[model samples]
Target: MKLVEVLHMNGGIGDISYANNSLVQRKAILMTKPIIEQAIRDLYCSLLPKNLCIADLGCSSGANTFLVVSELTKTIEKERKKHGFQSPEFHYLFNDLPSNDFNTIFQSLGEFEHDLRKQFGEGFGPCFFSGVSGSFYTRLFSSKSLHFVHSSYSVHWLSQVPNLIEKNKGNIYMSSTSPPSVIKAYYKQYEKDFSIFLKYRSEELMKGGKMVLTFLGRESEDPSSKEGCYIWELLGIALNELVIEGLIEEEKVDSFNIPNYTASPAEVKYLVDKEGSFTINKLETTRVHWNYASNTNNENIYNNGGYNLSRAIRAVAEPLLVSQFDPKLMDLVFQKYEEIVSDCMSKEKTEFINVTVSMTRNN
Candidate 1:
């Protein structure tokens, strides 16, 4: 599959839209807020640019998109007040795949701006917001233009599906049953994609600029550990059941694979060191439950943990699934998936290991 064309979060503010189903990602952002604040403070103190150019890579639409912006601005304003520095202009560039829902993000900017004014008052930055359409794997900004970079719950996505996966039939990701070769292929792809990511970001950021990124990762060295790959294992079981029912072609399941990887902390450190661009500041993992939002006000809407988790996964995975399977069968597919996920949740505390890394460009 052409990942750049097919990969994107489900758009709009509807029931299954990413905007509504992204509480898990929201939690990750909040978890990494202190890291982000420190990065911004360090970057601002080093260069003190009058106009701070920041990029939120893989910035899909919705409240989560704005949440990152709000965090950065508030921290900078507080620092400026404490240090008695002149007010700095803020330039934000929101980037994602070419097919991302730029319209939704643009439509909400007016209210976002008004809120910034009301909250920060005279200390508020005269912030400028623009949408850049393209992949972060490639260069999107001029060299040495960006001052700070922030991405949460992104960057684990590989640029393309890994090769040499014919042995991975009946599975969608690096599941426990996947052959060793299949596991090797996925990690090799991640190493290549992440190295390229570091190289390009290093060029875009000014010397000493800081970055903070959070994404799905595993603490275990084993690539097929349940902490990293069990979610896909359950999804595979759901799809195999559909195949048994003859709702979709068996060959379709065999050929379908997700273009995402969950790297271990060691794997990430190795690539960053090999890339020779950025100095690692902090690397740590935190666990987030699969159905973290079920206890919120929307609890009645979800009613069950299985349904809550299913909607969250569907918001992120539907676009890729629809490209290969019949879009009409999505509701049925996810219903089966909910049953599987819920059943597993009852027996264990299913959680995702999220890795948050803070880094700075080398002088």
Candidate 2:
């Protein structure tokens, strides 16, 4: 498949499948709330703005945006009371890609409008909320207009496919055998993306402002290990099946690759420090289990809201599997995934799939 085709397929699959799921939403909320609350407190205590302006970059649809806004409002109120100061007016900017589902976010906000007015009273404090659609890497706000910025589970995404992947003549991302050339190209792309991200964020953020972000990361530098991402391996197996069925050419399937960039905490710190605009205040990496058994008692099978390892495997494989494989074959693929997970569970544990990093823009 063409690179663009692969990107479209993967992006669509992620949005419809993983991004919209309730299990991921619940886990994201729990993991992010505390960090957001603390960041708000720090922003308020440090800046003490009578009118606070905050921006949430990559604030996708559904409960995620509301969860962040709710926590922020509570933090602002709490800090105001603790400092014996009047509540400040809040101006919030919720941003995401232009293609994101803004309707859902807007609908949720509309439902809470009455409640918000009741709590703060009509014009008790100026509350302005606007939705901005654009790439976060470029200018999204007026100069020095923001006091706090928050982004979660979004930065790892590259603005575009890495240039190296585009340039590679041979199998860039996919090969039956580990190819050093492909790995080098992937890292070069990641480096370029990371640098661009740092520069963009530095330009947008005001002095002493703060940003909190979380993304998928790797624990080891080793590229061959499953520690980087088991999901990729699972998808590879499904893709091989598609090749056998001749839905996609074997060469194309072999050339297909997942563009994942994982930076260690130390590496991240170096990048930020070199940018000369941010200081790493706190960085912590934690493991979040995306797959869990619906019933803790069911040892033989795993299910969570009808999404288990089998379901997840299928979701990732659907791009290559749909036209190629029949329903029965698809079922067999899921069964195979179940066996893989079962064997994995028997031998070891699954944890630490995501990384959370928090930083402050230097004055």
Candidate 3:
């Protein structure tokens, strides 16, 4: 799959749309709220600019993007009062790949602004949001134009699939069976792309500008740790079942690998230092469980959890899977995938290591 062309969350508010199925991402957003609020407060307390600019990089299509914008509005209101001045007009930029359902987020702006007005009592500064289309792996804005930047559940994705996965047969992502060379290839790609990301962002941010980033990461140095690889491991098993049943070919499975990687905290700090653009003020991890569907937590909920997980995975992975496997087998593939996921979750806890880092642009 062309990462630029098809790497978007399912669009629209339909049942399968990312707007509906993005609860996991929403959780990540909530976890970062305090960190983001604190950064924005500090920026206003120090810089005290009459006009402020902020960008949400890799902001997929969902209400959570508005949630970030809304909370920032609140933070600006509080900071303005505490600092004895009116808040600056906010220029908000929401960025994602070109294929992202930007319109889903864009369509909600009228409502977002209205709610902000109601909460801020109509005395708020004018806020404008624009959808910018591009990869975050390269420059997206002008030099020294932004004050605070935030990203959630992104930055782990590579610009493209690592080129040396020819030996990573029958696995869609990093698996135990993947050789050391395959892992090396993926990490090397991450190092190059992320270094470029930092260089560009450093140029775009004003002195002392702050950024908050949160995404999937691992606790162990091993990239194939349970936190990083188990999801894909089970997914690989699901695909192999289909292969056994003659639903999909083994060659197709061998050819696909997700353009994403999970790093340990040490790896992350190493990259930050290597890039030489930002100082890591705080790096932390939170464990979130994708257990029984919270909306329905019963014996049956375990089954529901698997279904929800499948849909969530489907929403993101369909583009890649469909591009390779026949569209006719989509339902069957996921049905079997759901069952396997359900059985596995019942046997053990399914969790992710969510990594968050707060950084300051070097002066």
Question: Tens digit of lDDT per residue, candidate 2, span 275-354?
Answer: 77777777877676545423234553343323364554354345444433344556655665566665665566665355
C-alpha-based local distance difference test score of model 2: 0.63
Candidate 3's displacement at residue 161, Å, is: 0.4
Off by over 4 Å in 1: 295-303
The lDDT of model 3 is 0.84
Per-residue lDDT over 157-274 for candidate 1, one digit per residue giving the tens place of the 0 to 100 score:
9899999645688999988778898999999999999998999999999999898999999999999899889888888888899999998888889888888899998999999999
Better of 1 and 3 by lDDT: 1
Off by over 4 Å in 3: 292-294, 297-303
Q: Global CA lDDT of candidate 1, please?
A: 0.90
- Structural similarity to truth (TM-score) of each candidate: 0.97, 0.79, 0.96
Error of 1 at 316 (Å): 0.3
Report the alpha-carbon TM-score of model 2 versus the true structure.
0.79
- Top model number, TM-score: 1
Deviation from native of the Cα of residue 297 in model 1, angstroms: 4.4
